[model samples]
Target: MHGGILGCASAAEAAGLWVMPFAGVHVWLTPTGHERAHDDCACVVHWSEALAFRRNRAVMTVPLALEQMAYCLGKEAFFVALESALHQHKISAEEISSLRALLPHGFDELFRLATVSAESGLESIMRYRLSLHGITVRGQISIPTVGRVDFVIDGWLIVEADGKGNHEGPEQRHRDHLRDAHAAALGYDTLRFDYALIMYDWPSVEAAILGRLRARAGRVVAG
Candidate 1:
């Protein structure tokens, strides 16, 4: 039997690691020998053997938690957490290498996508999804008057991933409006997506981006 949190719950405790909203705590406990615990809506319990157990720590190590997270969060969410952890320096390269060795062969490409460039889970997910569509996204780009933008595509469109914590309230909204206005004046079109839109309604977001890109391409050809 193990005490304390493990897996996704442990990863969520780490700063900058974004996890999907879940109820109740995740704990590792002993089940009938070799049997894993059944997860319910309120709590998630793992009865499997821990990869590395530390007596002094209250939670699983960042690497172990991330390794366990793969099974619970699936590829997209797990990849987002991995990149966020890397960007926050919560996990090191050596630790990641060790973690990779323990994972199954199918996870190889997902692990390769981990990068420190994504400032948030939203950006990490967005960048990965866009890549799947063969879109080239340049992240964290700086335009002269616009300061630093989240991503730039086709050298004309700016994409911003807005998480709830950072982009909230009227004042912040006003600031964002000004930023978009300034960007537009410089001939850069801006598309700002909040957490819900990017996470849930992706088809619409993809259509908007692709439609804009296609329109821009048509205009350029006509010119």
Candidate 2:
């Protein structure tokens, strides 16, 4: 019998084991549990019990399951679980569509998840799209002259996703302007888009980006 180190008090109680309240949950162990440790608090479970709990799918929360999978099976396995959750709930399509509207360059599903805010559920959608495109999109980047940009495309194009929080103060706006100037001086193209452009007028933003990419391609060819 194998058991994980962590289990809820209720679970331990149901198993007919003596449980000691620790934190918010019960910790279960052998009668001599107190004899082993000197200071640090840790839960001990029988190996058989741990294995049983691990095999019991109903015992784990989604986040817990994800963490377990990441620890045991690695990141690729975690991604599989992520995609399964998205599809199982029938949210993947909606998320992908939303991101497509915002980013025409195409993104992977992970981006959808990354950007889905808990309040609005957009972070997941953003994470998913970014995963699909394999864009390696990060939330923020700081360059010496550019200061910081919201996102970097291929380490060259600085993309700013201008939400209200980002543009609230005059100081922020001035700082952004300086960052853009610095990025330009460093031969990096900067693209800034407000929330409206990202959420409502994405086509225009896409076109601008596409045009710039095309121009850059032509320059490479000519040079």
Candidate 3:
């Protein structure tokens, strides 16, 4: 194959998409009929069993690419992608469900986490991590005095993940701070984490969330 057109990003980065991150003189298996690249990259080719499927359902095909992603990158990466695609309207939950039947082991759980409400890959990753711990999370929750918050846990805690582009500027940051304060005033404990903290330092972030959840439990026990 000369030109490859897979347009999904790496296994990490919260549903970040890319089309084969390898650059220049890339030597890899590209199946049978992948499109010739319009860019500057030399390539070598090898055959794969996945390419034997129908013209529309071959190795580089959307569903097979998703399946390859699942098996190659693992379940979490696949579902993160699934969430991003659903969120961006590149694919629907129904379409994802259809792919589920064709995928191998580990796909069922990924299908479970796939949804359209996830606004960003960061949110998707957070929600998925929380879910593995059995914590129920509600998306884009609206309170009486507060507008839509990112996610709500047990109706007692708010988890807001501010991506760089969304919450970096002074004016936007000021508004986010005010929202956190207002949410706290309304008896909701707010945990604000940024992209780096959530993505790179997940254990710390997870601990903070678990600590808050435990405190909420302790409050319940006391009352």
Select the stronger candidate by lDDT from 2 and 3. Answer: 3
Residue-level lDDT tens digits of model 3 in 1-223: 3554342233222234422223333222444446465455454332343422534343344445555556555666667666766666765556566677677756676676656887876888888888888777898788877789889988888999887687888998889888888888989888999988987899999988887777768642111
Ranking by lDDT: 1, 3, 2
Root-mean-square deviation of candidate 3: 5.4
Runs off by more than 4 Å, candidate 2: 1-139, 219-223
TM-scores of the candidates are: 0.80, 0.42, 0.76
Q: Model 2 over residues 1-223: C-alpha lDDT tens digits?
A: 1223343333423433222222433233333334244345353332222222444533433343333333333343344344444434523555445424433242243334433212111222233334444445555567886675566666677766675475778898888788788888998898887766655675586666556656775532111
Worst lDDT 10-window in candidate 3: 18-27
The candidate that achieves the highest lDDT relative to the unseen native structure: 1
Kindly provide the TM-score of model 3 when superposed on the true structure, using C-alpha atoms: 0.76
lDDT of each: 0.75, 0.47, 0.65
- 45: Cα error in model 3, Å: 8.2
Which tens-of-lDDT digit does each residue in 1-223 have in candidate 1?
Answer: 2343445655455444776555566665433324333444455666555466533333457776676677766777678778878888888888888878877887887776667888877898888788777777888888987889999998999999998778899999999999999999999999999999998899888888888887888742111
